[model samples]
Target: MSSAIDSKHDATHVDHAADPEKIHEQRGHQPGIFTDKDLMTNAFEAENREHEMTLWAAVKDHPMACFWAFVFCFTIVMESFDMFLNGNFVALTAFKERYGVPVAGGSKAIPTKWQSALFQSGQCGAFVGVFLAGPITNRLGYRWTTLLGLVLMNATIFISFFAQSLKVLVIGQAFEGVPWGLFIANSPAYASEVVPLVLRGACTATLQMSWSIGGIIVAAATYGYNKRTDEWAWRGPLALQWVFPLPLMVLIFFAPESPWWLVRRGRTEQALRSIKRLGRRSGNQASAEDTLAMIERTVKIETQTGGEPTLLDLVKGTDLRRTIITCLMYASQNFAGNLIANQATFFFEQAGMSTDFSFKLNLINSCLQLVANVLAWPLSGWFGRRTIFLGGLVVNITLLFILGICASITQSTATNYAQACLGVIISFVFAGTLGPISYSIIAETSSIRLRALSTGVGRAAYYVAEIPMIYLASQMLNPFGWNMAGKCGYVWGGTAVVCFVSAYFGLPELKDRSYRELDILFHRKVSARKFKSTVIDVAENE
Candidate 1:
């Protein structure tokens, strides 16, 4: 994901040692001194050895890096905007007129089965798309694959914008999922490649920030138009998806290819030039040759023995833990009560807010998420990734337990207000920490060699988790179904507690360690608590 810095650090262009950029970081051993297998063993030969740039050095260096990172992150805004709007549209009065089923008596229209299918269709596409990212990204390179996704998304949005029936809209949404799957699975990897290890936390945080920005804009749009009677109510919002993707189509074409990808493909000259461009733009102190030298050597060493890894390798030996943890981390988001966010409109409607005000509350909710992402940079770096994530888990457990209790006790105007406020609190806690920080965990944990495939596989786990939850959310929240409002909190509250336990035990602290260093730590099966203080050598020279 290192777009601007062009694979600036380690071979993968991400921080090898976790300094919070986990996607591209690589632990080093003074160049070619160790065999690929020894990449981990020799890393532990020394202790308390600092490798790479200081945080100040990373932040103060990259102006252009920031620009490119924003470009990379903005890729998801259209997707986020579309998704948020899609959910809230069901809450609209006009939406009922268009898609709702009639009740036996003279009651308000209820959401039909087709609408549930429409909501799940995108996930269906996303599931396939995320799994496809590994092969495509590895074969075509990150920039082009991303551009192809944008083109596909735009075409699908065009179909959805003027959709005439639920079938058409469902088809469009499903097609739209393909591109987003690529973005979610690969965007962090691309960002990691371009930024210095020091800036990894802030840059990767942009991935989460982008989603909130789109959600905020779309939520605001929903507030403005959900009350309208004509087709403009829905059509108008779908058109807004176009706004974010247009500039990206052109901008991505011109953006530098990831040097890590280029180097892997044997395009040494192009990789060097890309690195040079990023360094010049970002005001980086490291030379293109220095960065490219590490990249070339690292790729060469990994290739020499591994002979190009397959998906099977992700589940074998050291990477199995990485794969399992990363997958569980993505799965944990929903299990840990992110389902509340996915169906926020219905949750708000149940909590006594009008559809319009609920949408506005969603807008506010997105703003809080945005602010949380902004704060994640400093907090994820200073306090360490595990600490902040564990804190978020605790917050989730407490807030959700309180909500679960409240929902079980009563249903009234005052209670409704309390439930809504608590939902807001939980949104802040979950979105700020778990949602954004998980990218760091997935990216930082994987080895550079398997980063693309493993991340894709992990995203596959996300879709797997999403499928049942979609049905559960429908059954629990829909008027046509169970309609268990606050009581549903109890279901996911238990899941959050499970995630908190898993993370405390299984998720290690890779905060400032290189990927190579992480390899050693995981292989040695180091205790999660010991990772932060367990110093090891990461010599940049070979």
Candidate 2:
């Protein structure tokens, strides 16, 4: 099949060795022999070498890069911990007694409006933080920006830990979200830049693993405290957040900066130094130089194609298409039933499960998600990104549809149990597929020149979409509001169908493709269906 497709586009492959002058003409320079032929050749050879390297070989060659990527991506656990704490707090008896108003059945409940507000306030701050991250990282670089965020996180946790009222807690969540935005937006891009192509998908996907780790920790903490009659039950989880930032700050201070960012800033010497630090095990100065040249060439092509990178350029030309794909890919997490998993503790309680059982189920759900995320690292390498993502979405849609059917029938212990179980299954499937793969896709989809900013935009879109979904999920679960219960599955399942369709038509297969190859394919406007099959010679001069 690949052979047939390659033959069909045989005319499209330009041979720079045969017609070097054509490269200059097509790239808007005068027809002439290459001025930096050695640099171009080294870059071409490096890209090909990277494309052919196995995952284990890449890991062995770049151990320091892997270590730093893990350290940076670990910052996401803080954000995930806080978000998970907020969602489960509503189910805490002491929390409701303190912050909630009177509801029916002679019991106290946090008003749906306040629940929605508390959940969305963080998202609002994250929205601002994501947009702010692009410019700040561009100026300060990833390491400094990360340190700044950690410092701010240390200061902001005071508000939540010491809050006297719900309003104060809301303000605290919003303030804390600013740094979280920095972490989420920066970490995946950092992972992408630090590692080789074979490690890129797994490293970026490790962000989701960190997130699930946070979820698991919070789940266990919340379960441990769910039955307590004092405010300490809720405050314990909030205070535990303080443990993450300082240690991460110390580690991040020692981590090397992104070489790609350095190259873009014209700090070639520093970029080479950073590359050496990243690939220390290889200890080959020549290989490091070739890698540096590869980054320089990709950056040059992006600049020639898109001119100066800006926020506005995200929506211009091929970049607009890239930006849309990244944004929607991130947003699809929510549309494809993640809200149900996120709010599982509250969701199960409202659906008539016992409070103790609900918390236990939430803990189980978190554990499953964590394991699924670990499994995804190998699955991603085996099945490829597009296949795993689309397959996961289909399974999610099917389970949610079945859950809705169970809800539509008579409400019973059996049906409620079925719905709760289905939510957990949906979450497991998501963690394995769409959840992790989206990180790789968004990181790979954007132009290297605009990668940090593009990732920010994509993450911002996730927070943006999350706010409404959080609100709607609150209403659907609240007895005083929509009271949809398991019926919410039908609505989310319908949305997941939309995501699957769009992805089928729009999500290209990016398995094992180098950044330069991706840039060439996007520049030429290749159809998504043709991406895996279309052949291009990376040796061809841009």
Candidate 3:
């Protein structure tokens, strides 16, 4: 094992002109006279090398890490599936017959007030759940916290499956949301921790892919059952929620706990074992040791600068800046016209599309979202997070404005179709960029000590923004309400413009940087725009 560095050493700036080879040659001549700085420098070099590794190489070296990340994040699929079902159930004929009231044309539709309540119920529960996830994960670690959520999800499904009243259904959705919050909050943090730096962006981004998968399943299931007049048309999809948690609970039990969490708890031996398990396919004990060393050093440095890990630290000093960045980064997703995608089926139905056509378009839209999410993996590697996210927002803003313009034209088949097509394009761009890159930003931005909590707070902010937006979208799309239909684009496009401006100024480029490097940058209070260019010498910093 390599010698450990003293945790209390004050960090200094590195001279960029110094050659690494010459420093190593000097160390080679020194032989047995190794210092703490030398050991720290070696750990940093190893981590940097790992960062410089290609995506394919990282996957080959850490296949188990990738597999486990997928397994844990798969919990998100269930969360998104149920959330979609909650929104789309209003579009189901049988669901409306069961729970809706008579409208002007003798057609039954869920009242706009009820629609807003149902959507906000889940967000309310998720807000509580995400805040709860922080302390629970801090105490029990990621594996057990996720296990508890999965178990609770099984019990919550019964509430939705047997719901006979609109109130009961709302309660069920809210109950189900608790576990969903736990899953969403934990997945990205777990993925970021278990994978190497090269895999971090791609792995964390998979959470969105999981979300898209769930949406696709819901779209297909709801499409298949859209014409059914029986209660099973709605109940069957609610019952499908049971299919995910049991299998995930089993798989997650055997998954390795995040070594970063283990290190934070001061369980170094367990952290080392976890790291070795994650990298077992590589068959390199030395590499495992080095990885553990890097995690410890990063954690220790954070501790030195930030002191004891507490939720309050999230709002103190430089951490406050980080907290705001994470909160707004997540909050921006909700503002970037995502509500249009979330309530697509209902929006299409109200926008003059037939029931059959609405379901079909939503299914196709779901499939496109899944494809866009998959494309995000390579795009993240190629163009980086900030560029893609900002670029995506630009496209979404333009599409939304065009959608509003289409709505202003004489209502016709062509104009309605144009608006629907525009919505689909916006969903594709969003799923590809803002949706996936936000996960990477949240994972990379927070300090390791506060990752789970920061993520919880960030995700909680998402629901905070989402709850109100869902209500507004319900009001905008409901025929009995505002009836803005496609014109709602102007409202959301304006918000997207706000998101783009904030991201332009606040979002930093984190591609190819290690967590340890990130800690140094954050601790130094580097400006957001300067993160990519700032250089640190790990030995001098230590």
Candidate 4:
């Protein structure tokens, strides 16, 4: 019955004049029975040409689609809250100053090391969460997996209001790892899939923008609330975070399911409907035919391979090599020594400032980072990835060395403030370039089948690296007394040098390429420009 249906469909496509030239090109495979099936299949495919044309035309004309695009952007923004809140412990500097335990019999010493240790615990929790995401998403699918994370995230934040002990604080922040991991693992892939290839960079960057925006909001809220009130300041910000996930939950309820997921499950009819909806929303800029062709090609690839490839499959060939390299690339971002440098408000206070001074300085640094994220759009848009990636590493490396010198010379004096300001400036510079662009490369480089797993692996590396970096930054700077913290410049400077070398030899140009083409670029010996050309050809042909 299935074969008969397929034959009839083939005949219908042939009568409607499917792309004969392309079909013939594919059919000239070899003198085999399989070649004959390809020709028959091409004939059946012709009937859908009209459906393709209409579906595309409708998508191009649809207005709601544009609105949904923004909906997509905002959903991603909610996830960006992880980055925003990740470092927000700075806002508690004042409270810590008045109430925190005294260190080594000091009258009013801030527990900077203790605080960093706590935060690193949260990062470690997030690592566990990231490791768990692959299996959860594999069993539950992206939508439900996100929903589960969202629920946990919101509950934890709300529960944080009741915290009286440091243990509870750690738990609140640690459980935060779950939703943060889920979103970080899945959101990039979702954003990458939703947009057309031409606007891929900008669209993905918009997700980064959402992150910056969330950071700005967190900074503004934490700074403003802490500045005005002495008590219940942290509570306000904690309570307000609940609002972030609510709207996203409502929208995802109404939004279309991922077409790729449907095709993977062999739900072709449903996938076609979802594609039509996407086309309708995109103002018909993409047709149903375009989406179907994409799904069809993807399905064909998977079917030919017999099943979804695993991590082992990645290790065997160019595809696996690309995955490993990309994972390391993201890992480098986490280990870039920037997070410690950026979130060092408590460290700054421990070094010599009063609690109030640390809070103000941390606010200022976050604000600067927000501004840098805004500014990055133009520079990253104009410059290619290689230049920005390498250049940023060099600039950061130079600053880290200079900072180490200043820290050693200043030793706990007024000059420390100057060194702190310089550190913030470097933070701004790093955020502007490598921040969003790193995400772009991560999203572009993985195959669809393995996207969730790859992203989870990459982010897991990031969080795992965070454990040591944050730990070292605190212990070496404080109790362990490595003097590296006091003159922390050399450590970060060395890290900067490593990043520069990595960028020079290891990174590939991923600018303006489709996700599919990225699959090829990572696997094949194609140049970046040629990779872009190949993707365009694939898109146009579809």
Candidate 5:
């Protein structure tokens, strides 16, 4: 069955880019295979003027899908919260004394290699955890896999709170990262599976809002607690990490597993139930059965064409191209010169802003980021992903280059203040554009079976670029060290230029395509330029 389906698909498939006249001739009439209106989810979404209303309709229509999306998105929030907490804590007087060696008359402190790397241990753990997400999710399924990760996460945070020694604390932070890494890498793939295609981008990008929310919460808490040199300043936030996952664990226990995963496992009935629940029509599995059968069909066809999904597939042929784009997609998030977004508080302080003022500024920046993420929801429909992704990159390339030059002239306190404001503005534009969209891009780039695996590879947290970037970023910003302050943007500016060139030639407009259509496009090996105009009859083999 599978071999026949693949053979038939290869025979009938057409590349509109290659033979435009033929596709142009057939543009008016509906193809025989794509008869079902619901299956063309992206068409309904794009043709309608009210995509914003469509987003609400999707949530109202599938409240459980919304629930699972929100739950999955919090793992993203956990990642954001942990990142900000680590970034902010490094600037704290209490945390520094506890974890660092004294330098300049004991009035200020700088972290040793051990302390510097300890903050990064979570990223290291995240790399390992993301790599493990594929097998863990494959064996245990989404719910248990997520629950187990959360359990480990909760335990590690507890360990961080009670630690009396630096060894204990660093070890705990590293271990704590493992589970949330597992959680984040798996969460986006889960949301992509459960949500209808119409709402996939919005659901996946909701992570940015949750991420901003967590950062705001951390900034506020860290500001309040860091007044005196006490353990509560850091420990309070450490303990607060548990607040997100505990309730999430309860919620996942009640949520159905991903229907796509169920289909691949040959549990079609369970898959139907899952789809019905997500579709908000549990009493009527008619539509649910259709979607489940579609998944099963795709799996069967793919099994014949290739084999069971593997990480190795990500580095071969068409999959390798996707893996590169996704890897660079994730890299683009960091390398696109938003270092200010990562270390906003430090940048503020290094610019002569007082600690309280820095925290206040950080709070405002985070609020802007949250609002921007929310605004991005509507814009994600109004503009193609390639447009926003490149727009942000182009703007940042210019901003980072200018900002780096400004860093070189930081002799003037006034100049530092002005650039600090500029950095905030740059961050806002970034959040409003590429920051939220990257999660969706990476998840949507791969086929269903490899979604989790590809996302894992894309999110391999502790990569080579980061080691030098972190070390140099630390050296440049440390008050007692090189203190390049705002000038560090020069380094990131170069990387942003590289990212921009690759994205210009390679990034496709994947804004409003159904998963099946996307798979077909990749299967044909269409160039990025053809994506917006390409026509795919996803139901051909069905």
Candidate 6:
């Protein structure tokens, strides 16, 4: 069945590669040195290399790949602040109370409850945006889709500066969500496709590292403006996001398009041009040929596997069931209490800490996360995704346990400081492994057909879980106070168990496979946990 699908898709795609002019006309580029065959060869070579070598080399050699990886990492960091903002500072709450337009109930005013809804609405929009990627960007090309997303996100930030009402503010936020989905959906495949197969993991890790940078950006921005009374103080930090995207947009405009998307869309000539430029080889026809051949094989396999699976299929099919497990693995990270740790300021103050202390502590955690992210790149290579994700989950479970203890500490005896230090340590553990590595795994776990959809589903689940947590967070703190620590502790503990089980039974090893080869694995009826072992056994005996 898989073979049949591969052949049908391959035949359709190969026909386009045979006639390069058709692709050239579509992309509006003149005849180039490389041909579609050369692209095919390059892809094949990359895929055939051992997984560990390919993942790391991609990071070290390919500038274009690294650049996009950086953009994705930073984008996540920036967007994550929205999650922590209201949760972190009392000053922000003050701003809402002071400037907020009154509505029906004072507590449930336009800006009060509406602000919470805006966050949820943005998440909902993100779900829609993520779903949009498979069809729109899949047809349009990754480069174009990414650039469009970047523009919208930056525009959203710029417009947000002027938002007078909560409704207008959220509408701006919704636009930002779409671009985020595009980047998340496409960049993983994009980064993996461009590098030497040996260095793919490192390159992807570098992309994941951007989130730490984003964490720093949000933390620093929050800390810097924590006490400012000026109208533009908070707005200034928001406006700075505009600066990050403009230069990135220009770079992306000139950046090479995703070779896989190009090949899939039957634009083989452009695919050849892109691969050659990325490989830094001139007139190396073999590379282009390899790229085309691999893509041909992948497309054929996709066709045989059956049509793109729907959301319902996610719960029903073998490949898709694996995809769901992968999504759940990542979702576990979000719901695992890691985010609440980052947003600890809100809870800390509720426990009687001063506003100044909360900001300082949040900044400290961000710095710790930065150190951990840097450490993850080398650690991921040494440990691989499976080990790191599992280890992180275990450590997170322990930290949550400790946090519960610290939360019980009283302020009179300086025990609260100990609690703060423990929180920072937990942040370090999260940043080092699951934090950066999870996204890389998500990007690689599924085939192109369901990659975006799976990520959307996973992230949407993450946010959906967040909505309830956010709503009840303050209320929960009011009564249980220190006892509330166990709520997140339980969630993280459960998450750890799920991850362990998945690693033992459901998760696949995507450490070093090329996008095309990975596609073949998805078409089969193998168990996810067994895939790595299955692939390795076949490799070793051969």
CA lDDT scores, all candidates in order: 0.74, 0.87, 0.84, 0.60, 0.74, 0.60
Q: Write model 5 residue lDDT over 343-451, tens digit each, in one string.
A: 7887888877887888888989989988888888778756778888888888888888888787777368777787788788778878888887887888789777787
Error of 5 at 228 (Å): 2.1
Clash count for candidate 3 is: 1
**How does candidate 4 fare on TM-score?**
0.79
Q: Could you give candidate 4's per-residue lDDT for residues 1-542 as a string of tens digits?
A: 13433343234333324443455467462323223333334323422432233223423554344345445556545544544554555436445554466556564433556556566766776787776777677666667777777777778775456767666766777777667778777766666665444334444555556665666676666667656435466667666678878877777667766666677767778877766665544334234655565556555543444376465654555656567656766777754547644455555655566656766776677667767766765565456566777777777777778777877783657667767676677677777777767776777777777766777788887777767787676655653345354367788778778777766766777654444445546555665334423332231222
lDDT of 3 at 261: 92
The true-structure Cα RMSD of candidate 6 reads 8.6
Best by TM-score: 2
lDDT tens string, model 6, 333-414?
Answer: 7545575564666545544567678777777777777788788877766665777887787777777776666565554436
Runs in model 6 deviating more than 4 A are 1-46, 50-61, 89-115, 165-171, 281-283, 307-316, 409-413, 477-491, 515-524, 536-542
Model 2: per-residue Cα lDDT over 216-324, one tens digit each = 9999999999999999999999999989988998899989999999988899999999999999654888999999988998887776765557799899888899999
**Clash number for model 6?**
42
RMSD to the hidden true structure, all candidates? 6.5, 2.8, 5.4, 7.8, 6.8, 8.6
lDDT winner: 2
Q: What's the alpha carbon RMSD for model 5?
A: 6.8
Q: How many pairs of residues collide in each model?
A: 27, 0, 1, 17, 0, 42
- Writing each residue's lDDT as its tens digit, candidate 1 over 313-407 gives 88887778889988998888778777777668778887778777788788788788889888887777676678878899888888888887887
**47: Cα error in model 5, Å:** 14
Would you give me the overall lDDT of model 1? 0.74
The segments of candidate 4 whose C-alpha lies over 4 angstroms from its true place after superposition are: 1-94, 97-99, 103-113, 227-231, 279-286, 309-311, 341-344, 347-357, 378-380, 410-414, 476-486, 525-542
TM-score of each: 0.88, 0.95, 0.93, 0.79, 0.87, 0.80
Which structure is stronger by lDDT: 2 or 3?
A: 2
